[model samples]
Target: MANLLDQLKSYTTVVSDTGDINSIKKYKPTDATTNPSLIAAAAQMPEYQSIVDDCLLAARKQLGTAATDEQVAAAAFKSLAVAFGKKILEIVPGRVSTEVDARLSFDTEGTLAAARDIIAQYNAAGITNDHVLVKVASTWEGIKAAEILEKEGIHCNLTLLFGLHQAIACAEAKVTLISPFVGRILDWYKKDTGKDYHGAEDPGVESVTEIFYYYKHFGYKTQVMGASFRNTGEITELAGCDLLTIAPKLLEELQTTEGTLPLKLDASKAAAMNIDKIPMDKATFDAMHEKNRMAKDKLQEGIDGFSKALVDLEALLAKRVAELNVAV
Candidate 1:
């Protein structure tokens, strides 16, 4: 039997969710995704150190000696995103989703500016939107920003998504794709109930399945890309999704398995479901978000974690700048 990766490809597009090039080369996912946390982790790796150094050098050249720590850090991040995207593109024949600063989750203007900067960097490096998807948080502001970006021919991948409201919002905005987080939902439920979920009944799996069905049922053009997977079980459960972004570890785990992978989601079947499509306005979206305690808490937590990681990355870049100054 072929590897699980190959099997999954038959049903859904497999995306590598890492900033590590070696992992992408190993699993050869059809697409790839990167965030601040993943890029920070990759920066610490010896193999990726050169990319950091290059970024630092570029920052110094552009910002000059008087650039503030925050400016230097931002430049380094943009450089790292571009570098990782270039390397990943060499291995994967499909698109890569590079995220904006999580700190800009609620700031539509800031998110748009950062997104434009990221895309500009990619374009300078000769990568087009055809192979790039700017990843943004699925907040109301972020979704609206994505709507504008999509019109400009720059596709988006809405990440940190949880509830049906978020999905509906993304579809309404006409985002190119939405990554409903599967593993994080599982984590939330496990922590809330203090029990391990098993098999197909997992909350994460259920969440993505429901979102996938709704998108298909309503003829929403927004692609459902399941992400933040915790295990192969959750991934396999969402096999027939538009796309699934898997971490390096999970991708490796899937590559080792060689058995029958069953199909769990079908768009045609989903379209046949007896469900009415509901439009989500500001008032409705707010009410739904307030009702879903899980979504509310998880969204805040995700934002906080990403913000903290961004701070840590900035500190690392500051240290690098200090060292570079001493050398100069």
Candidate 2:
């Protein structure tokens, strides 16, 4: 019998949710994803120091000696992200998800420009937009940006998704994929209600299951990828999701544990479940999302957290660039 990881792979695409190259190599995920936090963590590591330094050097050559420190840092950050994406592509046969700037989560045009810019960088490096998933926060503005980008042939992965409102919006917008965070939802519920959850009873698992059913029941083309898992049980519970981006620790657990992982959420079953079709018009969507206090708070928190991570990366890059200049 195959390990749990191989069994899960038989049902869904397993994506490595970390920015660490070693973890990606270890798990051998079909797809890989990186966010501000993960990328920032990698930037601080000695293993990734060459990636940072190379990006800074190239940024200097492109921006010239007179470029401002801000300009160099900005260019370096963008390069660092694509550099990681390129490296991940070398390992994974499937796509790599690189995120848009989190600070632009609320600005539609800004998000579009940033998304296009990232894709352009990937294209410049000979990777097509089809191979890259531009990750954006699931805010209305971010969804709108994705909608526009999708039309232009750039695929998007909507992240920080917490509620039906966000999921419906992404589906209606025709995004390539939506990552409904399972563990984060569980975290919120466990803290709010003081109950430890497992398997089908887990709120995070329930959320993703609801989203999977909703998307399937309505015949939406957008794929649902459950993410941010706190335990192996949550992953097992979402067995039939379109994809699941798991961190390396959980991947290791799944690899070592041998068991029969059942298909818990099937599209065929979902299609026959008699669920209500959600109205995703702008006003209705806004109201529903606002009413879901957990979703609203967590969405803001995710954006803020990613924003801080990006800022931290920027600071780290700026410091590295300064040190290199001093050495020169």
Candidate 3:
């Protein structure tokens, strides 16, 4: 039998979900994803210190002694995103999904503006759209922003998606890709029922399976990439998704294990499933959004967490900028 990673790749495109270049290089996934959390973690790594230092130097050069910590932090984030994108591209032949500020999830206009800024930063660094997917939250506003961005030839990866309404909205908006969080869904269900889920019966696994079958049945062009994994079982359960973005820890587990990793999902199986394709208008979308409690709470929670992290990162950057000034 082929290696499990190779076998998994045969059906689903594997995406590395971290800013750690060494891990990505080791696993050699087809694509990679990065967000504020991952970038912040990478920024603290000694090996990636140069990346942050370079960004700090550039910010100082631009703003001189008056540069605020927040501004410096923004520059550091941009610098780190671009640096990660460059490294990811060298390993994955497909694309790298880099997220905009989660703080902008509810602010459609702000999200659009930030996405354009991120892409421009990448372009300035010689990375093109052909290898970049700007990650946005799957909020109604975020989807609308992505819709417009896609029209301008910028592709988006919709993340933090939990509900079918989110997926339906992304499909309607014609997003480049949608990351339906698998592990998070399982977590919600586990908490709700106060019982552990197992194997294919897991709610998280079932959620992605439903989304996958629906996308195929309706011929939706938006790619489905499962994200936010908790364990190897969640990863294996979603074996045949369009793509699966995994953390470095899980990737190492998969790489080391030897087992008969069979094809759990296929186009033929998806095609055979009889599922009604419900077209989502504003009313239906709103109703569906309200009904899914897990999706609703999680979306809000994720946005809030990401927004706060961005603020914290900005504070850290500002302190660094102040130190640089004092040194000069």
Each prediction's RMSD to truth:
1.3, 0.9, 1.6
Measured by TM-score, the strongest candidate is 2
Worst 10 residues of 2 by lDDT: 270-279
Candidate 2 vs candidate 3, lDDT winner:
2
Per-residue alpha-carbon lDDT of model 2 for 1-328, expressed as tens digits?
7899999999999999998999999999999999999999998889989988999999999999999777899899987888999999999999999999999999999999999999999998899987999999999999999999999999999999999999999999999999999999999998899999887999989899899999888899999999999999999998989999999999999999987888888888876688888778889889998899889989999999999999889988888888999999
Local distance difference test scores for all models: 0.88, 0.93, 0.85
Least accurate 10 contiguous residues by lDDT in model 1: 73-82
The Cα error of candidate 3 at residue 63, in Å, is: 1.9
Of 1 and 2, the candidate ranking higher by lDDT: 2
Model 2 bad stretches (over 4 Å): none
Cα lDDT tens digits for candidate 3, 156-237: 9999999888998999899999998888888898889999998899888888888888888788899999999999888888
Count of residue pairs whose backbone atoms collide, per candidate: 0, 0, 1
Residue 294 CA error for candidate 2 (Å)?
Answer: 0.7
lDDT for 2 (candidate 3): 55
Across residues 1-328, which tens digit of lDDT does each residue of candidate 1 receive? 7887788999999988899899888887889998888988898899987888888888878998688767887778667777888888888899998888999999999999989988998898888889999999988999999999999988999999999999999999999999988889999999999999966899988888888998898888999999998889999888899999999899888889899898888888976698878879888888999999899999999999988988888888888877777877
TM-score pick, better of 2 and 3:
2
